[model samples]
Structure formats: C-alpha cells, structure tokens
Target: MRWQKQPVHYPYEHVVCYDLETITDQEMQDGSFPPWPRHRPVAGSFLTAEWSPVGYRFKLDTLLCREGREAEFYRKVDSLLPPGGMGVSLNGRNFDNAVLRLQAQRNGLFDLRNIARQAESSRFDVAHLDLLDVFGARPGTSLAELCRALSIPVKTSVTGGDVADLWRSGNVAAVKAYVQEDVIATYILHLHAAAWREGHERQLVLPLADLAIWLEGEPGLRHLLSFATCRPARWARSRAPALRAAAALAEAELRLKREQDEAAFSAR
Candidate 1:
C-alpha cells in the first residue's frame, strides 16, 4: 500500500522524531548508586525511533557496541539523513550533539574539527531544530511543564537516571522499552509543535476531555492536541518579554566578563 507523500519543502510538516539515552562517567564518579561505581567509564548510549511522518522513516544503520561505535554511528547517521534535512531532537544541540561529538573524539572515531571547518565554510548541509531549545527558550516553559501547559500527555516512563541502572542490571528489554517511550513522547511533542507552526497557531491550552475525543480511534494519536489548546495570547502576554529581556541581560553580562578577563590577562 502506498502512503501519501509529505511535502519535502515544508520542514515544519515533516519531522523525524528521535530520542537518545546517555550514561555519563562523571555522573557515575559522583558516587551515585548501582550502575555508577560498577559501570565507571562505561557510558552506554542508545538511540531509538519514536515516530516518523508518512514520507520519512527511522534509519538505524549503526549499532552500539562495547568497543566504541562512534565512528560507525556517525557514518550511519550521515548516510541515513538526507542532505539539508533538519536534525530534530529534544535538546540535541546542547546535550546529545555535545556528548556524541565528545565520544567520537575520545574513541578517535572522526575529526570534528574538520566538521566544524566544513560548517564554517558552508559545506555542511544538515540543519538542526532542537525542541528543548524551543521549549526552554519559550517564555515560562519546561519540558514537563510545557507538556502540562500545552495539555499534551506526559509519558511517565523510566527517567535517564534509571537507564544506567537498567543497563547495568542486564535488563536490556526494559531499557529498550524506556528508550522507546522517550522517543515516542519526543515525537508526539514534535508533531504537535510542527502542526502549530504550519497552522500559524501558538500556545496549546485545550481541555483534556476535548483532546481525548479528538485523538480517539487514531493509533499513536494520543500525542496530538485538539484545537482548544492553542492559546498563544495567554503565553505571549507575560512570558515573551521576560524571556527576551533576561536573555539580553545574560548576553551583556557574559560579554562584559569576557572583555574584563581579556584586559586583565593583557595587563599581566
């Protein structure tokens, strides 16, 4: 059976939903329980597919391995992704990307310096759209808080902290389930955001009853919100300006501190 083709040009309409699970050695070294001390320096990472629109599909060309699979993972991801396709993630730029790049270097997998140079030269084709950045940068919002505020159902599965324990305990199945749920939640949120963007609507403030009714009979449809939830006016009224002003102040402070440190070092 042929599926309807999604518009390639409309990025907001076509989203690739994904989630990553990472176990940091630093967290382990902090005297955390269970997997911490035993699994020291063994950071297990997993990437899973949550959902993809009709046109796009999840491509897991690389498999995580004990001997460090950074090179393999990078190659597979590069091969699977389309040129210029946006890399969607919960907070990919800040967390996932940083960790992946660091791991890649530690494992001697790839030359990120070259990648940065290529990006500077406009030789890089892929763009990234981070949901965490969007939601966090959104006035007065956190992930769980945003979902609650938006009336999107939150998936209460195992948290990231639980992942390391699960892996160390040899419970691979549980870990997969947890990772899958995370991916699904991320995908659902991404879709809701995308729909809002395409429709030029803002703020999600639908009644729970109405949303459930709208989601009925649709598989994996529980993630989407109803029209009643879109209330841009409420959020815009207060949060927008506060976020902007705060960001401006933060930027100014950073700049001033950097200049002061530079001048002090020069004088010395």
Candidate 2:
C-alpha cells in the first residue's frame, strides 16, 4: 500500500477482461449451428483491476441477459468500458463481440460505442486483446487450455454448454456464479501477460499486494486516475486516503495538460 510513485505510463486506462454465456439448443448440439451469435447471450460479465488498499483489487460486474432486456444489458456493459482502456477476452472477436452486435441489432440498437470499434479491429490491435490472437491465432485451444499453457489457475465447474441446461432448470444463481468465474479467470490471464511483459518467465500466483507494488511506477497505475470518465469506487473505504492522494495528483496533471493544450491553440 506504500510505494513511491514511479514514472507510471501505461497506454490504456485499465484492462477489462470479459466473457459471455449463451443459451444453447439442439441445433448447437447437432453442429447445425445456426447463424445465431454463439448461443443467445444469457449473461455477460467483466473484471477490471484497480489500485485498492488491499493491494491491486478488482471491480467486477455481471450483466444479466434476457429477451427484452438485451439492450439494457449491453448499455450496462458499455458503461464499464472507458475510452482508451483495453478490453481483454478469449475468442471475443469472433464469438462474444458478434453476440453483442447481433443482440444489439435484434433490440433495434446499434450504438455499441467502444465495444463496436474494438470488434471491428484486428485481434492484434490493443483495442481488444484476444488471447487466441496473442498466441499465434491458436483458435482451436480454449481459454482454459490457454490458462493451463500459462500455468495460471483455471476454475470453472460448469462449461458454457452447460449454461443452457442450467437456465432451463431455472438455476439462475448457478449461471451467474459461473459467468463471474469465467470473467475472473480471464482477468487472471491478463495479469499473467502483464507479469510476463515485466520479464517474469516463471509461472506464479500474483499476490494482491504485489500487484499494487508491481504497477506502482508502471504505466498501469498512470491512467488509474486520469480518465475523463469517472471510475466509481477505484479504491475501497479502507484505502480512502491513498485513493485521495492519487486522485489529487491526477487532477493536477490533467489540469496542466488542459492548460498546455489551450495555450497551444491560442498561439496557433
């Protein structure tokens, strides 16, 4: 919780890792997979790490999916994604993003905002980090497989295929819990990549406190407080003092940028 602020300078504001759960049907089983976007999204969730007193913490959310509520669910998802921040997912380019677009179309909504643009980019683009593309377009390997490859823990008691049965059985809580698990696993994978970038070659569990320290002078912490959009609850009450200090520094820096830009415009 106490580290000298190093020269932090990450490219994006934050890294949000997400995934969607869809309802399946017999056609999916028959491999007669219709043009439908990889099962109708019954639920979606995202997880983004933040600087918390508890070390590096995460803000997690689940967007419940329903027939008439698809658009609303997407809106909630959009609200979490800040511009210039990165979105992370496994096979999201082909499956999850398409699901969002198709549902948005059905609901008479097309303004997907950031997600829409991310979907349009090449998977290698930083707009959205598709792990499948990160590892040489190994499309056949599942996210779980990729996690195993990285030696990161993979926890999922239920598969996406099982979601439809659980929904039909009316076990809504189970489905929600499952979706959260998927997103959390994805978040961990993102962390693994970050560690690797910092020259960590061995697989190891990342400590929450270490996350804060690791991001301390790095680019990851730079944008933690600089985005124009407000990030609610970046830090818990337990860490209010630290959060306030970071916010103050960010505000001053932002003000300086605005003044510099205005002066440049005037001179021009």
Candidate 3:
C-alpha cells in the first residue's frame, strides 16, 4: 500500500460517512407508522476516510446492538465522529441526527448528543454534511435514487424497511449488511460532492477506486468489490491524485480563517 508521494495538501484531515438502522415496528396497534422517538437504533455503520500522503484512505466499521446494547453502539459511533472532521450522510439531519440525539439524551450520553447537535449544522467546520441538502434537498429523492441518477454504483440487496423483519427472523447479518451498504453509498456520494464543491472532477475517481480496492481485503465487505470495476481509464486514474489537493487546501484555508478570527478577538 504505497504510492509515489505527492505534495498534496488535503483541506480536511478526514471524513466520516455514516448511516443508522433502527427497528421500528411495522405498524402500531392503530395501524399508523411508528413515531420518530420509537425508532430504536439497532445498527450503526460508518466509513472513515483520512488523508494519507498520496490521497485519502478509508476504513469501514459497523456495530450491531440489536438485543440491548444501544448505549454501547452509540458510543462506538461517537468515537469515530470526533469534532473537526467532516461527517457526511444522506437524510441524516432530519432522521439519523434526531434519532441519535434523542437516544443519547435518554442514555445520558451528553457527548454524543452534542456531537449530533453540531453535526446538524450548515457550517463548513461542523462535522455533518447531509447529501440530500447538498443536492437541493428536494422532495421524493433518496440515496439510492440519487445515486442512480449520478451513475454511482449502489448495491440494493435490502432496504431500511426490511431491517426489522430481518432482525426479528434472526437474520442479524442481513441487517448489518444493509446498514453497511447504505454507509458506503453515502461515502461515494460525499466523494462526488466534495470533488464538485472543490471543482475537481477527476479527484472523485481516486478515492472511490481506493475504496473499492480496500474493500477487496475486507472480508465482511467483499460483496461491494463491484465498485472497484467502475473506475475510469488509466489516464483519469493517473491524473486524480493531482486534482484531490483542492478540497484539502480548502479546509486548510478555513482553518486559517478561524485562527485569524480567534486571534483578533484575543487581541481585544
């Protein structure tokens, strides 16, 4: 795992793309959809990508707390989403962030609550970026649907609606797999959004290629290796490293601005 080192100043140090799976009943006694607070989180998954010397490298992690370990599950997810890194997700601000905050408050996990709060903001330095919001936050579009429109590779073995039934039938592996697939899709979306924001189109292919290549070695995620084949030609792959530097540099600029503001306030 080596590349000819390039002078790449990545803007952000790292990015964590995450998704949550909860077990809400099919319907209440009154036959209504489950309320928001009742969506008990059973599985959490995140893909963390950090800037390396050559480009960004990723690690995929997941947790299942289906029986009764919701607190532990949230804690593990929180540990990866430390402040000062980008937290990217799809439809997270409305659903996932609220669920995580409410559950963390109930479990006395104040740090997790605060992280969830900060992650819901529109600020650049905040840990959260909702792809739905990024892509106009329009009505009727979903992560899978949007990925299809953008031609990003998306796996659809299961849907969030199937999670509860799978868990109930003792198919916990299926639930975990579904959550992981969503997180990976979210990660792929974030890469495109970042590249587009930074105006570095070629930058998109490398991190994705890197992710697909990394998935090859991950026993639990080998099913997603199809993403590896979606990479562009050799020429595009060769130029991608040079293009990724812009997003990294943009983050550096933001950091510098924050420091300058703090220094001015201290001088007064």
Best by TM-score: 3
lDDT by residue (41-105, candidate 2, tens digit) is 88887777654334455566777877677778878877776467788888888888877777777
Q: List runs of model 1 lying over 4 Å from the truth.
A: 1-10, 28-65, 68-70, 111-126, 136-142, 151-154, 200-268
TM-score of model 1 (CA atoms): 0.52
Candidate 3: tens digits of C-alpha lDDT, residues 145-247: 8778766666568876678788889898888878887888778777777777778665576777667667777786777765555543233356656656766
Backbone Cα, N, C clashes tallied per candidate: 3, 2, 4
Query: Of models 1 and 2, which has the larger lDDT?
Result: 2
Candidate 1: residue 184 lDDT (0-100): 43
Candidate 1: pairs in clash = 204-229, 205-229, 206-229
lDDT score of residue 184 within candidate 2: 58
* Cα TM-score per model: 0.52, 0.66, 0.77
